[model samples]
Target: MLKFTLKRLGYMLVVLFIVVTITFFLVHSIPGDPITAMVQDLPEETRTVYLARYGFDQPLGVQYVRFIKACLCGNLGESLRYPGRKVIDIVRNYAPVSGVIGGLSLAIGFTIGILCGILAALNRNKWPDKLIMVIAILGTTIPTFVTAAVLQYLLTVTWPIFPTTGWGQAKHIVLPVLCMCVGPVATYARYMRSSVLDTVNQDYILTAEAKGVSQFRIVTRHIFRNSFLPCITMICSSIAGIFSGSFIIESIFAIPGLGKYFISAINDRDYSVVLGLNIIFTGIYILAMLLCDILMALTDPRIRYSNDR
Candidate 1:
């Protein structure tokens, strides 16, 4: 297990390095110059001075080396638009809002999905199952921004039950969280329902039923627990999606989060922030995968020991 973890961590570092390197070059390759974008009002002579000061006048290879060195030294480079502010500081300020929004959405979505799936599976071919299926389909089909706008119109504008935009109190979180969770919740519900149905037909489940175990015990203990392994794996991957969803939802709602920062970085052409954020997101995804692997090992005895052992 230790060796496996080390191997995964090594792979994660390699992936992060590649992502940062690609992002650095790609942002630089875009048409407009970052210095020009920042110093639009400055005279050409002043812009030239600014470019030279920032080493933007150097060759691309030289600039890349300088950027990498700065990154290694814990200097994410000064924001091209913000002038003196370091890119990392900007990311740190906004990441918490995204984290809260994404975390809550994941929890609520996963719970709702699991409950709906269990009900649909147990009531297979009945009205309850049909209702859940319809909801799941709609949830999957509708775009998140469309959902957010509609909810804003009905819940916030027409009814005035919730705030239309901005994040501060729990009330502000409600709409964005709902919008972010809907798609994943639907996907998770369908996956869970199918998995449960498949597990219920397995020989071990039949054996448990033949032993005269109560139906509730058979479903919860023998069926649900065993079937949950795949759901657990799905949940981990779903977390990455939650962060991506938060980017869109945050933009729509005007929430001050990492997503907002990401958008700002793109508009200002703050290459350092963009590269740093991408690296941060990639690290998060890899960490989540590692956690899932550990959880799998804990839950399944077959995975607990090294294959070589």
Candidate 2:
């Protein structure tokens, strides 16, 4: 187990380095200059000074080395557009908002998805099952941006029940969370339904049924637990997606999350922020995968024994 974990950590470091290197070069490869974007109409000499100030005048190799060094020392440098602000500080300010919304959305999604799946599976081929399946299909088919737009129109613009956009109030989170969760709920529901249906047909399930185990106990203990195993990996992977913030949802609602900042950084040619955020997101996903592996090992003895071997 220790060896496996150490190996995973090594792989994660390699992946993070690759992500950082790629993002650095890709951002630099884009047409035009960040300095020009920062100071639109600066005199040539002044632009030279600006470039020198940010180390942009240095050779690409030198800049890359310095950037890597700074990153190793936990400095992602200042935002090109925001001047005095550090990338880490900006991330700290925005990540919590995204985290809160993401956490809530995931909780809601998992709960609703599991319940709906169980209901549908138990009532297979009936109206209840059909209705849930239809809703799941619609949820999966609709785009998040469209969902956000429609919800905003119906709940905010027409009804005036919540604020149209912007952060601060608790009400601001509702629409975006709902919009984001729909897709996840649909996805999880389908997976859970299939898993449960398959589990129900297993010999052990038939044996349990013959033993006259109560329906609820059979479903929860015998079926749902086994069915839930497949979802652990999916749920862990989704954690990064949730915390990253849905770009469209954040933009539509003017939520000042990392996703909003990331988009702005790209458009404004703020390479520091863009590169830093990308690395952070990459680290998040890699870490989530590690957690998923650990979780799977804990839940399944087969995985644990295989690793032990």
Specify the highest-lDDT model's number.
2
Which whole-number lDDT from 0 to 100 does residue 80 have in model 1?
71
Which clashing pairs does model 2 show?
none
Off by over 4 Å in 1: 37-44, 242-245, 306-308
Error of 1 at 265 (Å): 1.8
Q: What TM-score would every model get versus the actual structure?
A: 0.89, 0.90
Give all candidates' CA lDDT scores: 0.82, 0.87
- Report the backbone clash tally of model 1: 0
Residue 13's lDDT in candidate 1? 82
